[model samples]
Target chain A: MNEKPLELIHGEIDGRISATEREELRALLDADPKLREIRSELQKLAESFEKVQPLDPPAGLRARILTAIRPPEKPAGLAGWFPAWPMPTALRYGGAVAFGAAAAVVALQLGGVGQGTPGMDVTGLAGTMARYQEPGPAGDISAIQLNLNELHGTITSHLGEGLVILDIDLTTTRPVAIVADYDSGRLRFSGYAQTDDSAMSVTNNDHQIIVNHEGPQHYAVFFEGDAKDSVEINFRFVADGQQLHEETLKIPLVN
Target chain B: MDTDNELELVRRCQKGDGHAFEVLVGRYEKPIFNVAFRMLGNYDDAADVAQVAFMKAFENLARYNPAYKFYSWIYRIAINEAIDQLNRRKRNTELDEARLPDWHTPEQAVRDTQLSAVMQEALMDVKTDYRTVIVLKHFMDCSYEEISGILDIPVKTVKSRLFTARQLLKDRLADTGLL
Candidate 1:
């Protein structure tokens, strides 16, 4: 009897052997009663384990697990949307004023009250304003840098009133588009506004807002609106419509 | 449960159906709890690990790949949590033996429980990796392929580990005259 094929018996008993191996094992066992005896012993060992009972989980375990997975309790009122970080003194007061002013401006523009605000068309303007207009009751800015190759910048954003405004300070030698990837239906590209720069234009699809800049420039861009708790922005430095440098910033939903 | 059924439940969960996820929790809670119980040798710690594993699974469901069985993916989480619990317990001087609750009552049940306890004692002597494969195969009834996917090990490695583990268990049980 070949002893090497003995391993096949173990695998066969465990249901881990292949079909061809099963045929081989059957032939080996039929020609050898000793191999049959070994198989029976292995089967008894496996059966002995079957006598071991599985313990029942605690009655409350299912409930406890479900409770833990239940979406975290949404923060109450405006407090739910913002991080619980202490706000800077200037931002505390200035943010509230800016938010009020921005909201009023957006409400007016949407109501067709301001036809030529130059930089208030992006739907995110109202959100941007709300984000920084008033000091958030809580939470810190979840920010990421736009550092990819020749580009360098910083983006700081906070959540409030169901929106976030990306306060982006970017300096790049190549023309770059600062894109905000908002969750579908959760966030809207309300509006866009940029500080004095070489040249800038904003366009958007359903999922993202693309800001195109021309030549070397330093600018602070504000993109906002919609009710998403988080946003992911990608900085794509482009030359002749081809992407040269790309970096991504992921902002988690605070709520 | 069929992977297709689980895939449907997972799709519902991905679409934000908390109730569907709760059904999944009910389905998996026992096996996951058992895995932790056998690994940690205590009820409270196992329960804690099981709860954490389910929560982690739900929170990270978006990252779950659909190509693998959901049980394999979730079992991996439970095993990791169990191993981590064991490591944490090792750091402390005293084991919380009190945390193991008693369930035996009838005479036959009592004998079985005692036998199980001896078996578990022998299991504790096995290394964690070996112990894991053994438990997955014998106690959890996981196929070798399932074990491979759950532990992220090659099939040959799984076979080798099981062989070593079975030998060790057989030796330990026989030494105690319980085999």
Candidate 2:
């Protein structure tokens, strides 16, 4: 009835108990009929689990995973120039290189120097400079390169004062949608500006972004959030109703 | 596969050998899928979770510490993903028991399948922490030590949780007269 005897009983069942503890369990079970019944029912329950078969994973699951993990092949022509990812996006979720914090740090370095053109959500070369400039008071600014086909660029981000600054230099010849998915639940997309005057329209619906482009162009999008949040941005580029590339970028914010 | 064999395969994967990773996937996909299915009580969701687990493992291969068993590392990723899915379901109020797939059968076979389904539903009712121990111990056939290492908990805690989980499961099955 006591937790100790029950633990010993489980250890015995799992073959994890010492000989002495095994004896103690056996004696306890012999003395208490109720405990013995409980042990029998528990044994049956465990056996039921053992008898249950392991269902095979959905067919072609291995292929799907292999395709996802396999390095993206360099595209042919202009598209090839912007191949998916040069490497797996290496943003640590909770460490010093956290995604949101690093993005915010990049924002701090920009220091309002690069404002997007009015009516257009594009930041110009100055904003790009601000993005890749020296690290802010947060010590170091983290940069992540976006390699999705037809939308290749770099992102500089950092976290400070409960805000995250994300500067993106996305180049593409076709229409694409970029989405930033955050987990903090408190994430607020308060302000956004861009330098690439080529952006036909930039729309933000909570955590999703749609950026439509006409011809080949270089565009810079800047995002500012008032709340410090750690989030993963799933930048998916879709053209002609087909997904061209996908990458999950982890951002860790400092509150 | 032997530990050395798995490590060698992982090394090949690190060297950008997709085929080698595919081999590893073939080896462990079933057990990982079963682990998710048992924990979450749904086959489609289990499949999705299993795929995500493998993709995540491959994506973070550089972070894989060779100090632990490859299976343990992958299982930890899967269990975390399943727990996350469970949390999401809780938040969305989407825990639908009606979504459980029906098993085809004759009268007797149907009874047996229903019996199994009842057990799985009971498993779904257990708390995630306790269900994890039971799944590792009974479904995956992991040792107490292996379960502890996978969960990053003390072996004593593993034993206690397993005991308590089994009791909870037993109570549920007994109430339904499935025992």
Cα-based lDDT for every prediction: 0.62, 0.61
lDDT of 2 by residue, B29-144 (tens): 99898888788876556765776787778877888989999999999999998888677557635223322443221222433466567878889889999999888888888888
Local lDDT at A91 for model 1: 31
For candidate 1, the lDDT comes to: 0.62
Per residue, candidate 1 scores C-alpha lDDT tens digits across A139-217 of 5466666666656766666554334556556666665555555564555443333333233434444455555544443
Give the share of true interchain contacts found in each model: 0.40, 0.61
Q: Estimate each model's TM-score.
A: 0.52, 0.57
**Superposed model 2: Cα runs more than 4 Å off:** A72-255, B94-112
For residues B7-35, what per-residue lDDT tens digits would candidate 1 score against the true structure?
Answer: 99999998888778988998998899889
Taking chain A of model 1 alone, its TM-score versus the true chain A equals: 0.39
lDDT of 2 by residue, A172-198 (tens): 767665545543244544323333333
Cα error, residue A171 of model 1, in Å, equals 53
The model with the greatest lDDT is 1
* Model 2 chain B poorest ten-residue lDDT run: B99-108
Best by TM-score: 2
